[model samples]
Target: PSVKSVIQGFLPGLALKIFLIMLPKLIMAMSKMEGYTSFSSLERRSASKYYLFVLVNVFLGSIVTGTAFQQLEQLINQPSSE
Candidate 1:
């Protein structure tokens, strides 16, 4: 396998792992910056932010990417004479 292909395969998973590890801390920091003085409030805001991130990134992103790939495939496979 070529180095480019290997890096392409590995980099996304590695980046995703790093992002997942950092996301909670990042959200917590942002929440603190937003000035939630109580622990419960901070946790609540952080959890909501995390949930929104997951919903949009994972669910909506999957749907959008899947549809885009399907369209690209169809376009590529379609005959020019049509």
Candidate 2:
């Protein structure tokens, strides 16, 4: 490859790396500007509720998935008549 093409290819990737590296710091700075460091009691409650919501969702989802798989297995393993 020519030098220009090589640099052209590398420039975007290097820029992307630099942008990604700086992104978290930028976000943290913005959060600080917004007074985002403090947590409240309500936030803890909301987090706990979110965890419970996820658990309930997973529980129901697994039950449905298991039933579907059981039905699929029964259909797939049915004996073939000659």
Candidate 3:
């Protein structure tokens, strides 16, 4: 593959990894900004936010990727005369 394709393939995974690594800190910052009085409350809010983020990210990512792959398969298998 060409360099452009190689970079394109690698960048998404790299970016995702970086985002996941930073997600906890990001959540904690937001929790602090929300003005939770106790550490426990802040922790709880951060945990919930992190959980929701992960759940939605995975759920939507899977659906979109699956649909894209299905469409790609159809395109590849279709007759060229259309």
Best by TM-score: 1
Give each model a TM-score: 0.85, 0.43, 0.73
Q: Rate the local accuracy (lDDT) of all candidates.
A: 0.91, 0.65, 0.88
lDDT of 1 by residue, 1-82 (tens): 9999989999988997799788988999999999898999998999899989989997899899999999999889994784
Order of models, best lDDT first: 1, 3, 2
Weakest 10 consecutive residues of candidate 3 by summed lDDT: 73-82
| Per-residue error (Å), model 1, residue 54 | 1.1
What does the lDDT read for residue 21 in candidate 2? 64
- Report residue 52 deviation for candidate 1 (angstroms): 1.0
Per-residue error at 9 for model 3, in Å? 1.8
Which residue pairs collide in model 2, if any?
none
Question: lDDT for model 3, on a 0 to 1 scale?
Answer: 0.88
Count the clashes in each prediction.
0, 0, 0
Q: Model 1: which ten-residue window has the lowest total lDDT?
A: 73-82
> Per TM-score, what order, best first?
1, 3, 2
Query: Positional deviation of 75 in candidate 2, in angstroms?
Result: 50
